[model samples]
Target: MVQAQDASEEAGTEASGGDEAAEDAQAMMTDESAIDDQAAREFFTSGSNLYSLGRYHDAALQFQQAYDLSERPALLYNIYLAHRDASEHAEAAVALRLYLEATPDADNHAALTVRLENLERGLAEQEASRVSAATAAEEAVRQEQAERERREAEERALAEDDKNIIPWIIAASGGAVMAVGVVTGIIALGLASSLDENCEPAVDGVRFCPSDPSLELENKQSALSTFAVMTDIFLIGGGVIAAVGLTWGLVRLGGAEDDEDAPTVSAMCGPTGCGASMRMGF
Candidate 1:
């Protein structure tokens, strides 16, 4: 009977120990949960104080820390509200997106959807602004290219006209005039030649020729012949001078004509007009 009483006592002690251990574990778990809840409450209280002080960015940070600790959708939504109040639209959008992901079927689904739509609209506005800027830049480049092409075409056309048409006309006209003057001078030279042949001849066989009376007459005739030869020489020289003068005049006139006919481009680039005129060889 004493052994049976001792065995019952041992079993009762084991049962009491087991129940105390279970209660201790339960109390530990409760204490840990209370510590976590206190930490979360502290964070939420700090965040609410910052929000009341109008320090939305600081409030958002505090709320984000509370959400990290508690994993509460309400805490995340408070973070989003603080971010929005701070005018940090991007941060607000991110925070809201996180909240929506956490609680898709929460009570405020319509409000979250409206916030996402506004964020999307802001993103769309940013995209449109970028596109407009790019299009304006492209249009400016195209306009500059077109203007350059137009100026180049105008310069090329002016150069071609100067090279091909006007120079040819001036050269041909000058050449024709020079040829006519040369032919007329040659005819005059032939007439002078015939006159010289008829007027001056010396007879070597006759002692006294009555037709050509004296040496004085012969001297006069020789002087006249020399004068005629000098006149012919002067005429030939004058004709050559005239022909050269004509060619020079033609070249100068052609230059003037080119200046007049070509389109004048104004330039502010220093002296010599910045090569606006064509350099055609005369």
Candidate 2:
């Protein structure tokens, strides 16, 4: 009988222990539920405050967090409202669609569907307008580049023409000098022939007898000597100048295009004589 009583007491103790464990588990669940509710309330309050401050995108994020914890269809509607006010049409449309799916029997289902369609259309137009603006900007850049290249080509051509003309000008100047020399030599020859016809030779070879007594033979002889000296001077100078000019011109024409310095030739005539000068630059 003592053993039987001891077993009954043991059974009572075990039953009491099981009851306490069940109560403890229930208390733990209640605490966790309270914590979740507090968190959800905080997120919801934050979302509402952000919305009032005109931070629609931030408000939408907070509302999404609250809905994640609570799984409330009403919170999804708040997210749609926030996204729509922020002009985030695509996000707003998605939120609205989710809300409608979650709450199929919502009172404004038809109106929300129509609003979603409008948002999608606006999104399409915005994308098309952006593509067109990009295309126009690219075309403007291409045209500007083409214009710049054309201007550069024209400038290069003008420079080349100027370079080519320099050689021709030098050569022409040399030809003109040679022609002047030839004319001067011809005048000297004419003066000599005239003297020969008007003066008679003497035995000493240094004296002359004038055919005309009043011809001023002394002055005529002095003029002839002057003309003879001038003719020799001009002919030698002119030939040297012409040769130099032609050679220089050929060199210039065949030289490298990048050479910046050019040689120059000049001619001068004075009462004493005529001569040519050349200058070169590094």
Q: In terms of lDDT, which candidate is strongest? A: 2
User: Which 10-residue window of candidate 1 scores lowest in summed lDDT?
Assistant: 1-10
* Shift in Å, residue 3, candidate 1: 65
lDDT by residue (109-186, candidate 2, tens digit) is 898888878888898998899999999999999999999999999999898888767766756765776677678678
Task: Evaluate residue 159 in candidate 1 and report its C-alpha lDDT on the 0 to 100 scale.
Answer: 81
Write one digit per residue (lDDT tens) for candidate 1, span 1-282: 000011111112223645988766766776776676667777788888899999999988988887776677777778888989998888888888887888889887888789788886897798899999999999999999999999999999898666555544544554554555455556545544544454544343112223555565455444444444444444444434444444444555555444444322221223211212222234
The list of candidate 1 runs beyond 4 A from truth reads: 1-91, 105-107, 166-173, 176-282
**lDDT of model 2, residue 7:** 11
lDDT by candidate, in order shown: 0.62, 0.73
lDDT of 1: 0.62
Clashes in model 2: which pairs?
none
